[model samples]
Target: MTGDTVEAVSCTQLAYAFGETRAVDGLDLSVREGEVFGLLGPNGAGKTTAIRCITTLLPVPSGMVRVFGHDTARDRMAVRRLLGYVPQQLSADSGLTGRENVALFARVFDVARRERAARVAQALAAVGLTDAADRLAGTYSGGMVRRLELAQALVSAPRLLILDEPTIGLDPIARTGVWEHINAVRAATGMTVLVTTHYMDEADQYCDRVALMARGRIHSLGTPAELRQGLGERRRAAGTGATDTLPTLEDVFRDVAGSGLDDQSGDFRDVRSTRRTAKRVG
Candidate 1:
C-alpha cells in the first residue's frame, strides 16, 4: 500500500465561504496512501465543509484539491471513481433493508449487475452485517445503521474513503465496534481513510496523523504524539510550571480550540465534560 502509490488526497490553501462566514479557511492537508488520517474538530469548525470540497460534493471556492493525482475540479469523474464518501447524515432509506441499501449504492456507483451482488455481499460481511442484511434499516440499532452505511461505502472498493462524524450518536461500546470495523477494512484493503471526528480518544487511538481545525481554519497538524509534545512545549513556555505530564489529545483540543461544551448543546458536550471531570478527579 505504500510503495509507489500516489497520495490519496491533497489540498493546498483550500477555502470555502458562505455569505459573510468563512466555512473553511486556507486549509492545507495531505493523506498518504493507506493511512487513516483524522480531521479533528468541534461543531461548526469547517471539517464537514472541507470534506465536501475534497469529495467533490461541493465546489471548491478557492485553492486546490486533488484526489488520486486528479484535480477535483478538472477531473470530477476520475476523482469520484477513486473515492467513496459516507456523509454525517443518515442516508439509508428507512424502508429499505440493509442489503438493499448497499445494493442501491452499488447501482449508483455504476457497478455492473453481474458483479453487484457479490460486491454487496462482500461489503456486508466486512462490516459484520451479514446476519442482519435482510432486516430493514429502521429496525436496526444505531450501531448497525452506521455499519450499514460503511458497507455502502465499501461496495465500490474505492481507493480513498471519506467519512464525516462516522460514529456520532452511539454508545461507547457501539462506537468501539464501528472503529474496529473501520480498522479492519483498512487492514484488509489498504484503503486511505479521511475521517472527521470530535472524539479525541478515537483520533488519538486510530489516526496515524491528525489536522486540528477551528473556526474554519487549521490551527495545528501532526501526529497525536507530536501535537501532544507541542502542547507540552507551549505549557512549559507559558511558565505554568505544571510539569506533571504532557496533556492528552483532549487537553490539547481544549487548549487550542476554546471549550464550548455545555449541557444543553448535545450528548457530545456532556460526554466531554464528564470525561474532563473524571480526568481531574483521577
Candidate 2:
C-alpha cells in the first residue's frame, strides 16, 4: 500500500507461540483502508494465528497490533468494536433462528437496545437473510448458513471485516452468492476487508492486494498482477520459458511458499487453542 493511504490494520514485529511452537514470528504487515486484502497460504502457514492475534482473539503483547490506530493490547474493546470477524469454522448456532443469532451479536457489540432491532433487520437484509431470519439456522443450506454468519458480523457495522476462509466448503454457485453480498455491502459502506483464503482465483479476482505467507512470515506482497509479473521475471532469469500470459495467484503461492507447503508446520494450533480463541472473541 502507498504511504499516504490510511492503515486499517498494522502489525510490527508481531510474534505468537503455542508452547514451543512459534506460530507467528517477527511478522510486519499493513492493510490499507477500504481495501479487500487477501492473505494466502497453505494449511499451517500461520495465517489463522496471525489473524487471531490481530482480532484480539488471543492475548497479544503491547505495541504489536494496531487496528485503525487503536493499540489492540491497550484498547481491546475499542479495537474489537471497530472490527467484525467471521471465523473459518461454521459459527451459526443451529438451534437458534437467524434473527436470534444476529440479535445476540448486536448486544455483544453493545448496540443500543432500541436500535438493536433495526440494526439486526438491516444486517439480515444486507446478507439476503431477511426471508429466512425467522427460521432455525440449521434448516438453511450451506450457502445460507454462510450468509447468516455474514449477517452476524455485519450487525455491528464495523469498519474492518475480518473473514477467515469465508467461502470454504461451499459450491461455486454458493460462493458467488456469498461474495455478491459481501461486495454489495462493501460498495455501500466502504468497509475494509481482511480475508484469508485457500482459493487463489478468488483472491486474484476479488482482492486489491495479497500477501503470500508461510511459516509465520510474509514472502511476497503486491497486487495480483504485479506479483505475477515478478514471478515471470524470475522465471526468465532462471533460464525458463516466461509466458506473456499472466500467471495465476496459485503460481505465486507455490513459488513463494517454497518448501513450506510440503513440510510440517513449525507453527501449531490445536483444537483447544481454537476453542480458546472462539471463547475470547465471542
Candidate 3:
C-alpha cells in the first residue's frame, strides 16, 4: 500500500505464543481503507490468533496492533466500537428470532435506543433477511443462519468488518450469496473488510488483495493476479516448462505452504474444532 493510502488495520512485528508454541511470529500487515483483504493460511498459521489480537479479544503481548489509528491495547473500547466481527464459531442464537438476535447486538454495541429498531431493520434488509426476520433462527436453513450472523455483526454500523471464515461450510450457492451480501453492503457503505479463508477460489474472486501465511508469518502478499503471475514467472525462469497454463491462486497457496504437514500446521484440538464448526454449519 502507498504511504498516503489510509489503513483500517495495521500490525507491526506482532507476536503471540501459546505456552512454548509461537502462534504469531513477528508479523507485519496492513489493510488499506475500503478494500477487501484476505488472510489465507492453513490451520495453525496464526491467522485466528492475529485476528483475536486485532479484535482486542487477546492482548498484544509482543508488538502493536492498531485499528483505524487507535492502539488496541491502549484504546480497547475505541477499537471495539469501530469493529464488527463474525467469528468462525457460531454466534447466532438458534433459540431467538432473527430480529431479536440482531436487536440484541445493537444493544451490546450500544446503538442509540431511539435508532435501534431502524438499524436492526436495515441490517436485516442488507442481508436479505427482513422477510424472515421474525422467524426463530432454529428454523432457518444453513444459509439463512449465516446471513443472520452477518446481520448481527452489521447492526452496529461499524467502520471495519472482520470475518473469520465467513463461508466455511456453505455450498457454492450459499457461499456466493454470502459474498454478494458482503459486497453489496461494502459498496453501499464503503466499510473496510478483513477476512480469513482457506477457500482459494473465493479469495481470488472476492479479495482485492491477500496475504499468504505459513509457520506463523506472512510468506506472500499481493493481489491474487499478481501472486499467480509471480509464480508463473518463477516457474518459467526455472525451466519447469509447466507454464502452458497460467498458475492459479491455489497454485500460489501450495507454493507458499507446501504440503502443510509441518508440526506448526495445527494440532489435534485445532482439527477437532474446525471439524466441529464445519459439521455444525453443514
- What is the total number of backbone clashes in candidate 1? 0
Per model, how many backbone clashes are there? 0, 0, 0
Model 2: colliding residue pairs? none
What are the models' TM-scores?
A: 0.89, 0.90, 0.93
Cα lDDT tens digits for candidate 1, 128-229: 999999998878877788889999998999889899878877789989988888888888889999998878999999999998888777788999999998
Model 3 has an lDDT value of 0.90
Which candidate gets the maximum TM-score versus the true structure? 3
Please identify model 1 stretches exceeding 4 Å from their true place: 1-5, 259-282
Q: Report lDDT (CA) for all predictions.
A: 0.85, 0.85, 0.90
Please tell me which model should have the higher TM-score, number 1 or number 2: 2
Residues 13-65, model 3: lDDT tens digits: 99999999899999999999999999998778899999999999999999999
Candidate 3 vs. true structure, TM-score = 0.93
The stretch of ten residues in a row with the least summed lDDT in candidate 1 is 273-282
